[model samples]
Target: MRLFFHTISARKKLVFLLALLVLPGGCSRHKSPRYLYGSNCGICHHGGEGMAGSVPPLSGRIDRIAATPEGRVYLASVLMNGVSGPIRAAGVPYRAEMPLFRYLSDEEAATILSWLSQQGETKPAPTITREDIAAARAHRISAGDVADMRAKLDLKHPLP
Candidate 1:
């Protein structure tokens, strides 16, 4: 009886361990930007490479886009509100609806953007801060508005 009880206890422990590994948010509250990206953006963006001509990739583009003040606003707004409709990245056209991540905190959004900026071979990318995200959140806008905002930006970088 004692041995059987011990075995059951061990099995329970194993199950608990597995749950921590497989569950969302994992075992910690503060997740790394890479981990955050994997759980959130990686599903569609696929390591920032994107999905063919549908979803636009972040590599080579985020760094340049985040460099300017207006571009930074666009990035923040996109995260808060999401964006849909047609857009171009690396000269390729993309038409898709990027879901909103409004639930993410300002710090989390900023960190994710900063991580994206470092992707691909490009000049040093600017560090997006929580303040930038907060500023964008100050004025809540719809996803369609964000799409319109993207239309006005002068993002002319050619992706390789």
Candidate 2:
């Protein structure tokens, strides 16, 4: 009888400890998609004369990026490698020259992309994959692509 009670108590203690370990990660503030964006992308993307006019608003961009193959390609590439010119999301142009974060992990990029896609805006969500980031990184991203994208929006500073 005592052995049975000890066994059950031990199981309960193990279960409790496991829950304690996992719960913090589940409830973490930065784990949230919105919070992640606000921390990372929002650094350069949030509004201002410098950012508002320069950065395309993220709130309504999912639909635009999902509208066509070219848009998705451009969107993913821009996030992976970064851009130096005007960018237009959903026909609305933003002039900020987004720089590359070459060190962002693939999982982090995917999380941000998935968050942007499901943001519940007019544009359909994009189906960006880890493979896409890998491919973008492998390719020779060009200055011309940047110039073309820049032409689509108004920028705060003139391109050098």
Predicted structure with the largest TM-score when compared to the true one? 1
Query: Which residue pairs in candidate 1 collide?
Result: none
Off by over 4 Å in 2: 1-30, 47-50, 87-93, 122-124, 147-160
> Taking the tens digit of each residue's C-alpha lDDT, what string does model 2 give over 1-160?
5575566777787786788788877543337766666667878776211254556666655544545555555566777667775555445566556777556666666667767777646444666676766766666576457456545422432221
List model 1 lDDT by residue over 48-151, tens digit each.
88988788888778877887788888899998889988887777888869988988889889989989988845566688899999988887888888988888
Model 2 pairs in collision: 48-52, 54-96, 63-123, 63-124, 86-149, 86-150
On the 0 to 100 scale, the lDDT of residue 6 in model 1 is 70
Candidate 2: lDDT of 19? 87
What is candidate 2's TM-score against the reference?
0.61
TM-score per model over all chains: 0.77, 0.61
Residue 92 lDDT in model 2?
52
Clashes of each: 0, 6
CA lDDT of each prediction against the hidden true structure = 0.81, 0.61
